[model samples]
Target chain A: MTETTGTNTRVICPKCRQELPWFALNTDTMSLCTQCGSAIRACVFPALLHTHQPDPDLPVPVAEGDASCFHHAGRKAVAACEECGRFLCALCRINRMGRNVCAACLSRQKHDGALPNLTTERILYQQIAWTLTLLPLLVFPFLAITAPIAFGYAIHAIRQPPGILPQRRWPMILAALLALAEFALGLWIIHLMLDDMA
Target chain B: MTAESPSYQPFGRSTLESSLAYRIRHRLFTGPDHLLLVRQEGYRETYRRLYFRDIQAVIVRRTVWNRIYAAWLGTFTLAILLLAAVLAVKQSPPPAALIVFLIAWIPGLGLLINAHRGPTCDTWIQSAVQSLPLKPLNRLPLANRFIAAVRQPVESAQGTLNPAALQAFATDSAAPSGRGPETSSTPATDTATIPVLPFRPYRGHAHTVLFALLLVDLAHSLFRFHSTAPVMLITGLILSIALLTSLILALSRQAGTRLPNTIQGLTWTTLVYLVLAYSFHSSLMMFRLPTWNHSSPASLLQVLYPPAGTSMITTSFLVLSALMAGLTGSMGLVQLYRRQSGHPPPPPSPP
Candidate 1:
């Protein structure tokens, strides 16, 4: 992802290396290369690419009177971790989730999946409700148990926001209805048998 | 620094042109010392300028629209093939239908392959207090060069040597000057703090396998492999279990994350219901049970109840499976629609 910056800052077609016109560069849109006919996006001009400088990250040499990093005794302390109050050298000071954290705190947060910025996994309750409501219908009898559960889940899901993609509530509604109907039908059959026995 | 100097280069442009889509055009201008961003709408224009020293971070994030577009295109093409196959079986089989089906696959494969190539990225320049999103660029090399150009002046202005310069200096001096004396004992980079997660594609391995199994099932059903019903049933049962496990895993992993659970449930339910419905239907067919025909029924009772000589258990299973199949199918379609529209999933609650 990192590349060396040359003195020339012209936006060039990656395929052809020909300098792109001002119109192509400023429009921030994809255009066909004049020579190669390959589609190219002009937003990637040479001037914008950069590798983070190593100086800011380099650990300062510790002197007799200077405060040292908590973890590195030979390095000067640059910043304090916002969460743990640990002294950190330039290399140890991590900017994560808009906070300056030490390596330990960042590691702990990531391990716990507590960092809001990093989402590793998610649980979708609506899918469970939908599955419960509809999947057991094949067995017929299982619907008697699952229908009420599905209906209750649908109501619960309505109050909660959906996952990474929004989903309509109609499927849950349909599942609830179908489950209810199956339950009612089962009860009706039981009542008929009881009446005949009496 | 003056207007007449070659350093004052025009890097971006703003436009007042508005199509039916009402897209707002913005312009960027770059100089040796400063970068200016301008937004023009109709007769009014607003501008902001950032000095080289004040710029903090330049980030380029890849968008998922290309993958979505490719998936949609592939799905559409597959659907056309499915329609052709269904028509060929339901009516007089035509050689032209097979040709159309085979030809439709070429575009479908191309779209999927294109999607696998990844997306063009959107670039943003961030200062301490504000972030400005540059126009999206698809060319990786050009984008990298653009970042490097912006970085060079900013690093120079801040009195910090660029990475290339530092690397060159280190190579020439034959000594590690940046890292302190205790660098040998400590790791060069904090791997734990890197925040790299395992890559999980939208359609995972289980999904691909399930799709393949369904296709095979469909082909078998179309070709009338009645003797292979048991084999189909066993395969379907395995698929059902696999699907159930994947669904549970997916749900548990996302439990605390803010996501619309309904679609996940709908997709799982649809797949499970399809598997269950097909299994039950096949079982009934294997047993030679009389299928209930609503159109030929004499009354409502006949429609609701099994006809004479038909097993009540088999009839109930058939009816329930059909009902579930219809419900789950519609639900899955709704979920697909919501996803395609780019509705934001619910945000995760703080732990």
Candidate 2:
């Protein structure tokens, strides 16, 4: 009838470094290591802990291409960016003539870094986000220059995630597309207001 | 970013579970919908563990329930098809199409309702097995299996759950009728583990249906309006919104996100009102005049890069398109919810 009866436990949490004065009883608990609270499991009531083995043997190196991406280590990068040879994650890696380009240098190529095909998709998303932003030129002061400049930059960032980017050059494409959308939207509004008055 | 990298498609779906076919087994060809793949894996791992050796057990377990549930769902689908066919045959006017739609809608509603209840009957049996505290086999893979099994009912429920009536169910859905995780024993109190409603995969068929509906609306709007100036704006807005809502919900869910379910309700109401408001007034009046053209409700689609003077029909059609797009998104998400709600084939015994 003892509460900690099933305890053969001298186990401490890998997290807080505190001894868990808890019972395992008949149940095996896959719990965070008690001391550290990192995820772990106590297989049996009397289970013992072993020294850490951090050197998990990853897939054997083929050495055919530069070492696989650190994050997705199994996958081949095939080619690295000429500027920065840093390992790019799949999203970070861009394929041009079959070479991987990292993000930062890619952004430098075009003002905003949109590639050709990406511009259309990004603009579609931009239209939505801009609508949500509701940046009316008349409502805000000093917005005429500020807005175009901002949108020009936003055109670059349409598909940009927060990380190392790949080398890409489609800024011209996104800038032109965004400008067209904005110009069209502006003209339509003017025509609507004038017609309503008449 | 520059396009310097080879687009890495998935070589194939890899999973730790040995017994069950990768539910996301299609990812090899489907590319990396990694988020969806991972969730399916977690569910699959649990599924294979419980019934890995015993296909017979899984069959027996699900046969009665699956047959009944599938029948219900299949019937509703057939009824809807039938009504559509009937309307085409009748080919007369408003009342016949409405009658057919209403008549078929009931069975379609009942289909998922019947499918949704499958997991409820299996609950206590699973709980008993999982309750056997202090065992090695009971650990693992076993516990994970239990979680997957518990999730199956919610999947089933989505198939039967009246989606339109989801608003009504939202209040009671928290402590719902179907079985879910053993909340009492669970260490982590997260909503993802709650198993209230399982997420389903997106089906292209759902989008096709919505596309058809939008086309119908567009035809009506264009023919009714004299001018054709606002077409592009209408087209862009229509396509985007029709698919956006469901896409948002499914993407967030697939990413294993935790948005306030309450917010979903608010969005639902916002959606309903948007549709209501559009129908209530001369929603197309903005395009009535050349001068009145783009600034009006029709011009709302100027957001889609409208021409200087688009037609009223085109503009109204664009709004309609956006609404349908939004519906497509919503339906796609609902489909995900339904798929997640199916009976997780039980996991295999520990190898």
The numbered model that scores best in TM-score is 1
Give the per-residue lDDT of model 1 (tens digit) for B1-351: 011221344553343446886655566667657776555543334546677776654544444345444544655575566556655865745875787688788878878666654565555565544556665334244456666577567767765534454333223223333322323333233223333333222422333334344444444333322332344445545655664565455544433222233444444554455666657655755554354444542332333322422553543343343334334444444554555465443344446
TM-score of each: 0.30, 0.22
Residue range A125-156, candidate 2, lDDT tens digits: 33333442345545543333344654655554
Worst 10 residues of 1 chain B by lDDT: B1-10
Question: What DockQ does each candidate score versus the true complex, computed on alpha carbons?
Answer: 0.01, 0.02
Cα error, residue B329 of model 2, in Å, equals 33
C-alpha RMSD of each candidate structure in angstroms: 21.1, 23.4
Estimate, for each residue in A1-198, the C-alpha lDDT of model 1 and write its tens digit: 222232222334433344444444333445655543345444322223333344746898999998899999999998899979999988899886467899888777655545522332344456667777667767664555667777777666665433222357787667667657867865676677789999
Candidate 1 Cα deviation (angstroms), residue B206: 8.3
Per-residue lDDT over B1-351 for candidate 2, one digit per residue giving the tens place of the 0 to 100 score:
344322323322242324655433212111111111111232121111122111100100111233434443454455455545645675858676677667776766666655543321111111112211112111234333543442344234222323333322222223434212322222222324422332233233433344344444445434434444566446534654664554344334332122222223323433443465355433444443344435566555443343422543344344444444344335434643553454232243345
Number of the top candidate by lDDT?
1
Candidate 2 at B192: error in angstroms? 25
The local distance difference test score of each candidate is 0.52, 0.37
